[model samples]
Target: MRTRFPLILLLNAAGVALFMSWYLPENHGLWSTLDLAIFHFFNQGLSADNLGYAWFLAIINNRAFDGCALLAMGGLMLSFWLKEDPDGRRRIVVIGLVMLLAAVIINQLAQNLIPVTRSSPSVSVPGVHRVRDFIAFSTKDGSRDSFPGDHGMMLLIFASFMLRYFGRRAFLISLVIFVAFAFPRVMIGAHWFTDIAVGSLTAVLIGVPWVLLTPVSDKLIGLFARNLPHFTKMNRAIK
Candidate 1:
C-alpha cells in the first residue's frame, strides 16, 4: 500500500497538471485549436446533402443509443460473471456495485469541483451542422454546459475499474468500448473534443487511481459483501 503512494501521486499530479494547463489558458491555446479542428472534421459529415451520414450521427446520439452502450458494458460484465465460480461471482457483484457507486460519487464531486460551464461546439462554433437539425427525431446536438462530459467520464471510470479488478483483457475491451461509445457526442457536435479528452479524462485520471490503487475500494467491496444480501440462490441459479 505504501509503495503505491508515489505512483498515485504521479498520476494525480499528471491529471491536475493536464487540466490546469488547459483551464488556465481558458481555451485559447493549442487545446482549443485541436478542439476546433476535431469538431470541424466530425461536424462536416452532417451536411444537408448527406442524409445517410446525418442519420448515422442522429441515431447514435439519441438517448436510446445510450442503452446500447450500457448493454455493451453489461454484456462484457456478464461474460465475466457467467464464467466465475459462485464465490467469484459474488466478488464480481461487489466490485460492480463499488464501481457503480464510486462512478456516481466521483462524477458528482468532479462536476462540483470543476465548475467550468462551457457550451458545446454546436452552440458555440459558427456555421456548424447539428445532428438535431438533420434528424426528424430528437437527438443530442448541443449542451448549455458541456465541460467534463458525464457520458465519457462514466465510460472511463468503467474501463478503469475493469483494469483494477479484472485483467488486462477486460481493461482493453472496456477501453475499446469507451472509445467506441464516448465519441458520439463529439461527432455530433454535442461536445467538444476537450470535453472528453481533457475534462472527463482528467477527472478519471485524478480520481480513479486513488480509489482503485489503494485499499479503499477493496475494503468497500468487502464491507458490501459482508453486509449486503447473500447471493447463494443467485449463484446457484447461474450454476
Candidate 2:
C-alpha cells in the first residue's frame, strides 16, 4: 500500500499534465477554441428565471467560502460527540486541510504558468444583482486572466477528501455540490468551464495521494490531540 500510493499519485499527476498540455493559450489554438466554446455555452444560458437556482448556488458557495472550515472542525467535534472512530474522523479533517493547502499552491502555479486571457460574458447572462439572498460574485471586467477557478478547486478538494472516507456515493453527491456552487461563477460570467475543470482535477491529482501516501495526517492529528488535552474527558467519555 505504501508503494502503491506514490505510484497512484504519480499516475494522477501524469493524467493532469496530459490534460493541461492542451490548455495552452496562444500556444495551442485548438484547445483554446474548445475552452472558449464551453465557456460561452455555460455563460450564455444563464437567466434570472433561475433565481431559485442562483439562490441554491449562492447559499452553498457561501457556506463553502465562509464556514467550510468551521463545518470541518465541527464535524470533527461531532465525531467525538457521536463516539465514532477518532482516527478515521481525524484523518478526514486533517487531510482535507492538507488538500486545500496543496490546491492553493497549485493554483498559484497554474495562474502564473498557463495564464489564459479572456473576457467574461456580458452581464445580460446573470449580472450581479443585489438580491437579498443572491450575491453574484462574477468578475465584471471582460478581458482578464481566468485560467484556474479557485472556488471550484477548493470545492473539489473538499469533495475529494470526503470521497476517501465516505465512499463513491459521497463523491457523486460532492460532485453535485461542486457543480451547483462552482457553475454559478461561470453562469455569472466569472470563469470558464476549463478554468474550473482543470483547476479541480489539478487539486485531486496533487492532493489526494499526498495525504494517503504519507503519515502526515496522522502526525497532524496526533499533534492536535496532544495540544488540546483539555478535551481529554470528552475523548474518554466517547470511548
Query: Which one is best on TM-score?
Result: 1
lDDT of 2 by residue, 131-230 (tens): 2324455323232556566667776766665565556766776677677656766654556566666655665566556654466544655666555444
Screening candidate 1 with a backbone cut-off below 3 angstroms (N, C-alpha, C), the clashing residue pairs are none
Estimate candidate 1's alpha-carbon lDDT, on a 0 to 1 scale.
0.89
lDDT of 1 by residue, 1-239 (tens): 33388888999999999898888885459999999999989877776789999888888888999999999999999999999997888889889899999999989988999958899989988787777676687788899999899999999999998888788999999999998889999998899989999899999989888898898898999899889877786678889
- Cα error, residue 219 of model 1, in Å, equals 0.6
User: What is the Å distance of residue 142 in model 1 from its true position?
Assistant: 0.7
Q: Which ten residues in a row have the lowest lDDT in candidate 2?
A: 123-132
Task: Report the error of model 1 at residue 75, Å.
Answer: 1.3
Please give the clash total of every predicted structure, in order. Answer: 0, 1
Candidate 2 ranges with C-alpha deviation above 4 Å: 1-6, 13-16, 24-27, 42-143, 229-239
